[model samples]
Target: MKEMTKKIAVLGAGSWGSILASVLVENGNQVMLWTNSEEQAKELNEKHTNEHYIHDYTYPKELITTLDLKEAVTGADFVLFAIPTKVIRPVAQQLLEVLKELSIKPILIHASKGLELGTHKRLSQVITEEIPEEYRSGMVVFSGPSHAEEVANKDITLITAASQNLDNARAVQKIFMNKYLRIYTNTDVIGVEVGGAFKNIIAIGAGILHGLKYGDDAKAALMTRGLAEISRLGVALGADPSTFMGLSGVGDLIVTCTSVHSRNWRCGNQLGEGKKLDDIIQNMGMVIEGINTCKAAYELGNQLNLTLPICHAMYNVLYNDADIQEEIEKLMTRPGKSEIEKYDEC
Candidate 1:
């Protein structure tokens, strides 16, 4: 079957967003890369470079950069949001207005990971609430163990396109699949989103372990237990327990926790090295999603009466200014139980 070209408006000109936009352009899509920064738009339009995010990478010349939300989304077949989770609602609201004004219904997709701050809602839920059903065709989440730096370099990468609507997920999979990038379709949106969001918290813990000079034993243990915590929360929130074992779940956790490219892991490494969170964030110049995710998951766990020790520890360290060593000690001293016991309960 001949592939149909899509007009996609990719909101957010950050690393991941820029890379995905370029990929869409390469795939023969009419891609619009949107950024709030007029200067960034000018640079991308003129130089085909987004230096602040992905350095030394040239974007496809066919990719267009836009500052006008209305201009980007008008007649777009798909609106792919790659912005931070915290700003999802506001952006969705803004997008909603533009969609309404233009009288167009675009399929909404999000590549961002992280739960909403105060509501502890998944990013999909937030977008759904903000964008009325009449104004959109469907919703899909793009996630898995993907890093912008690797994808920018055209390294082999695999990711999932998830939605309750299986057809929509498959559609996304077809649009994104290429020789260097493979896309899988999954119907478990809840599990995929939960897994994708929660893994950042674990990645931070992994980075903390690394910065503290802990051996592989500790790193392995942290990741295992972290998966358990993720499964617990996901199950409580109506996600399939099996999804935690898939690409968006364990796959994402493993990569984010171990990779130096992970913003969350790098932030935790700095924290473990005795740097202040504010200072680390300032230096990093990008969102460290784990810090916010840790807080959201900590609260969500409490509400669900779930014990997320790793998330709780991260929360204390990030929000309470609690000592990292003390937090680790506390986690280590917790009452012992069979590892499978928690999994069984979840």
Candidate 2:
């Protein structure tokens, strides 16, 4: 697949989507960025800047933008869905309609991180549920610690390309890997997706700790314990426990929890500072994944009868209007248990 000119369709013009489109264009692919916002499409095409998303980053002049979903996806070699998780199923359903018209099957890749609200399905699961089998050749997940802001700036970054099919994962890696961007292949799709989605929940907790003025020691403890919590759930769901130690798991958790670029962390910081959830959402004007993920994880924990105290605490803060301090105290005061109780299980 080296030096092959492929037509790539990037769904969504959010920061992550725009950055990916730019990278594909840089790699000499024919790239089209699809956005529902007519204004954003115009800005991307004419101004070559997606200021609303990737701040101060100029898109490649060769990159195109279209408001028409069908036009963006028509005859694409690979279709990367980088939209919000809430709309992933709807987009996949719409893509099915487009595929019906074009009669084309392209490799499917998703960079979105979050579970579906009601169904709690992974993004790939949502795509599979909505899109017919004939319309997509393969599905892969592109995730890790890489942030859109840094990626757009051409900072050195590493990401995971995960699929049950190793060939598909490598194909994705071949297209995306360059000097500044590195890609690794993995077979554990469940662990990768689970880690990517669940880390946002822990990131919010990290931000809350930050806002509460908890020092580095407290933050370190949260991250470590958070990894344990994530690994337990991932293992329970049939993911390789070691995947939590990989790039998509602990790696992603570290970046999202500590960085200012993380929307989830920012939302949590606001919450810790005594802002209302509604106000935080309104002010950010972006999808803070952890808020919704918290709900899903809370429900899932209840269904699975798993003890996910940090997730439950965050859920209480967001949904139950519980005081953050009281919730933290509750978490801290929980009965002692072995540190690696679930470690051997994974």
lDDT scores in order: 0.91, 0.90
Query: The CA-based lDDT of model 1 is what?
Result: 0.91
Write candidate 1's Cα lDDT for 1-346 as tens digits: 8777899999999999999999999999999988999999999999999999998999999999999999999789999999998889999999988998999998899999999989889999999999989999999999999999999888999999999998889888877889999999898899999999999999988888888899999999999999998998898888899999999999999999999999999988888788898899899988888888888898888888887888888899989999999999999999877777654363
**Candidate achieving the largest lDDT:** 1
Candidate 1 TM-score, C-alpha based:
0.98
Give the distance in Å from residue 327's predicted Cα in candidate 2 to where it truly belongs: 0.6
Each model's Cα RMSD: 1.1, 1.4
**Residue pairs with clashing backbones, model 1:** none
lDDT, candidate 1, at 170: 83
lDDT of 2 by residue, 1-346 (tens): 4677989999999999989999999988999999999999899889999887777888989999999999999889899999998889888989999988999999999999999998877788889888867888899999999899999878999999999989999989988989999999999999999999999999999999988889999899999998998888888888998898999999999999999999999988888788888989998988998889889988987787788889889899989999999999998999888786854342
- The global Cα lDDT (0 to 1) of model 2 is 0.90
Q: How many backbone clashes does candidate 1 have?
A: 0
